[model samples]
Target: MKSVQKIMPDMRHFEPLPDMDDRQFQQWNALLESRTGSTLPLERKTFLVTNLGMRMREIGCRSYDEYFSMLEGMEGLREWNILVDRITVHETRFFRHPMSLDLVKEYVDSKPHDVDTGKISMQVWSVACSTGEEAYSLAMVVDQAFKKRGDESYFGVTATDISPASLNTGRKGIYSERRIKEMDASLRKEYFTPLSQGEYEINEYLRKRICFARMNVLDIDKEPVGKMDIIYCQNLLIYFERSSRHDIVKNMARHLLPGGLLILGSGELLNLDCPELEKINNLRVLAYRRVKEPNKDQN
Candidate 1:
């Protein structure tokens, strides 16, 4: 046999990614905070570097500075969305916080009994809803509450997130077995259709009941939907700076119907004094109720 000539792929094209220095990291951090109201502390620098490096490599960027420059102005809007999806944590599952679900069940159970049958319209807002788990969980709990009480209350969940990709996932309403594994078997059977590869999809009726929209929590004041009976915002405020968190909470409070529930992640906020909201006294979950305005004649 003739001696085969060794053929090797070109190595010159495979340069190592440039390390993101402190200044570059700070620049990206500020940019992220400005655009998304999320903070990346010094300890998360490695995380920032990894996510940025992966995106940069995909786009053949030579340095962090180059990538930063690319993520500016209207031309970078699409890329910025992709980067947001990658950098933002989307780790969530059905009923990830059982206390929060229990609180929601309580809120649903407390609905006035004198309402016209099937005329009780309850709207829920699931902020920072990663995928559809939290939103569907709310829907299931609310629906179960109504069913258990033999009421035909009409309820819907509006799920919002900053990540377009995550919103897309929510719209699809498909989740892996691991996502639903811990959920109660009855809920799984009732709301999901088992699919190939251990995946479950939300039933058509439940999926239709939730409207997933791409929304940045920072721009919540611009929400077009009317005030909601329940605004469930959990596991997201921790990523924001204190001022940003307060602003988000205040704005979200503005969207709550009087006496509506505004639930937050436990310990996510302390002493958040919104004049319109009074904190729920539950030790297991951090929550607030929008205070109904006093009547004009009331002293």
Candidate 2:
């Protein structure tokens, strides 16, 4: 028999795809809002085109056009969720923006015990709690504060986010060393265990205290969540248009207990026509408090 030599196939080279045009960008933004209830700004549009375009190429798409076409044809919601996750910013760290945490501490400190109901507890909702850092940080602060007061069981934290993947990571309570650097040394030692290579895992005690749920703020029904004492919806409203922001604020106010607090992103504010909320001035950070119920006799 004659010996035959093996043949090899030639690999073709690839090139960077073109950027998305304005029309395609608009379509993508509309699609995103329809799926995630968030509107993309011009800067965010540029970011998605630049970053997610690269991601599309990595996933074997030759161009933005092809990738978008594929996206349009997809039937399931998961694909849309994945696209939103790609473009959504998840920049968060332990104890991020201490001013917000300070406000939370103050609110907790001021809460009064129920004379008739025994020890009164408070509920905190960390809206858009990405990667669990903010929620866990909130839990730690509440836990530590109440522990010092001999009232560790008087508070609970409800952490919610739209991304299931991020929630899963948060629920795991494990983090790389860099993520926890800003955390207090004593806190780190108390709440986390060092794994190999500068990684740490959050203690189950803190993790258990938090209830992480996947939620879309726009579609959330107020009745199921009950009333909350403090709602931290920071850095989330900027992604919404004015009308959507107003709607979200109204819905949030309905869920807030009387005399509860509603914290918006530093860049967000209530509309002048919104009579349900009152802004708290002289604060170093952006904060607001819900107005108390009107006297029944006055009504």
Q: What is the C-alpha RMSD of each candidate to the true structure, in Å?
A: 3.4, 4.3
lDDT of each: 0.87, 0.78
Question: Looking at candidate 1, what is the lDDT of residue 287?
Answer: 94
Per-residue lDDT for 37 in model 1?
A: 91
Candidate 2: tens digits of C-alpha lDDT, residues 1-299: 99999876422214556767888888888877876778777766778777676566556666666666666644646555676667777888888778888888888787888777767688888989988998898888877777766753467788888888788889999999888887799999999999999889998888878999988897765438977888988778887777888888878877778788887778676553456678878456777787887662132
As a whole number from 0 to 100, the lDDT of residue 295 in candidate 1 is 70
C-alpha RMSD between model 1 and the true structure: 3.4
C-alpha RMSD in Å of predicted model 2 compared with the true structure: 4.3
Please report the TM-score between candidate 1 and the true structure.
0.92
Pairs clashing in candidate 1? Answer: none
lDDT of 1 by residue, 182-226 (tens): 889998899899999999899998999999998888888886878
lDDT of 2 at 63: 63
